[model samples]
Target: MALGWWGRQPVAVLATAVVVSAAPILSPAAGDRLIGDTLPVEAADALDVITPVPSSLGADPDRVALGRMLFSDTRLSRRGDRACISCHDIRSNGASAVARNLTTDGTPVPRNTPTAFNAALSFRLGWAGDIPTLHDQAELALTRPEFLGGSWPRILDTVHGDPVLAALFQAAYGHAADREAVIDAINSFERSLLTPDSRFDRWLRGDVHAITQAERAGYALFRGIGCAACHQGANVGGNLFEKVGIFVTIPNRSAEVLRVPSLRNVAVTAPYFDDGGVATLPEAVRLMARAQLGRELTASQTASIVAFLGTLTGSFEGRPLTASRASGTAQPGDTP
Candidate 1:
């Protein structure tokens, strides 16, 4: 295969940076334990590549509770028919399982809804990586015509009218529900959505029995093939941006450069890719390998990688995340 742009960059440079940057955040005592004589050489090597997600982001509890209620309230939408939960169903998959979701006016959303779990750990918000913070993301969703289509004034008016919501806002923010307060509450809840303690995380912390031999082999393959170059760090991929098809090409990709998505709970949040066109995890893995690494993985290699990915599924609020049955009602016209 010809060397693409990805070939020009040294994988070790980014990989080393990711590991070094994690030192201050990741527990040093735990790091010593992971690299100590207790673990196998492979497990210790894996620790230098990807650190475990932190257990908490330390968001405000009152704000988190307020955001939780506001998340489900339909009044936030222009037509009072949708909430943030409409596309991002936190109860099911943190995202819509379909490729895309329809807007309130029936227009299909341009990109797939990425999972809400562990998004706080990512560097930027959205697949484009244009939005800086969860607060901005929430604000965009609230006002964007393609999303909730509601203006701030109207949203605040509704909030002011509702005694229940107003009181909750007062308790959370110590003031009335203004634009900043509303967005801040939602952002607080989003920061609280971290999914920690996956099997892979346990393995990272030196629990040799957390994953099977086959899964460990899969992790080796995942790293050996250079997937870890971009998909490394606490979120396992969200720390940076990269083009999807560095070597080959992915058909129907809407964007070239994208924010590398977090692999946390990835097994549950499918169909894959920004378009959500890929239906299965194995297919997505194969497509990514060929496109990004310029390698056609054998069946066993694909299965092993898939198995390793399954170990990434973590608990949200003390319960395991499952694939959403009500993935999306929208068809594949322009939505998934």
Candidate 2:
């Protein structure tokens, strides 16, 4: 049982939400032998940094239910044609398969659309660490001219105006559509978007058969080459804000320091990096190895690491998430 931001602590102190891992599975022959029998005591201690995903969210069912519909409802958008789903697609790892997210105001969003899945578990929100919580992010995104281009009053009118939405919001919040209530419902629903039970998560939970030997080797390589220094938690890399070009120079430098993204579902969310410039995972991995770790990996090492990353792709609403575009390094044919 992995614990995310919801299970660890209440959202009142969500900024400091740190995860506590579940008890490790005590198996030898089933999952990756990275622990219990195979890994030494010191090596196992290193794994303490990584945790498993929680099974469920700590939110009101009614509010979460309402939030789910609101998340995809274009009616909530300013133009009534570009809702949250226009940028954050649930079917595609909680993000649109594009570099820059589009807005209804005919202007491109300034930053890449980070995955909303398991986002509550992050220490800080947004690429620049500007937003504090999911609720704040929601409120800001709703009104940004380059985003939904919506105002709370206008959104409240839309929600209260529509008979269906009004009923849902009233049922969930015991009140008509309002800013606080709407944001709360959306926040609650976003908390429910955790993608747990990945193969790596299963392995962490003590199932040796969950991941393959190659993936285990890749995990070893991921840490062995120091990739896990920043990417070392339940969400993997969202905990820290580190400089992008620490080791080597990358093409077209943007910001010096950036909020690290979770590597939990990195395989499927391609055209990687803050700017979404890197198109393929292998290319991104190779670039990261050079830029972040000062290590040059061979093709086999990159492939193995990518294989391990594929294990990070988890399911949503009981359906497993598959590779979106075929242009990435780890595709459907790649073993998990």
Q: lDDT for every model? A: 0.76, 0.71
Q: How many clashes show up in model 1?
A: 1
lDDT of 2: 0.71
Report how far residue 282 has shifted in candidate 1, in Å.
0.5
Candidate 1: Cα lDDT at 297: 88
Residues 1-336, candidate 2, lDDT per residue (tens digit)? 112443333232223222212213323344444521224333433554568877676889889888877777665667766667566666666765778865565655677778778888887788886676677888877787777778777888888888988998777777788888988888888888889988888888889899887787777667656676677667876766778888787988853888778888888777687788887999999999999877788898899889989998888878877544432111211211
Among these predictions, the greatest TM-score belongs to 1
Give me the overall lDDT of model 1: 0.76
How many clashes in each structure? Answer: 1, 10
Error of 1 at 35 (Å): 20
Error of 2 at 137 (Å): 0.4
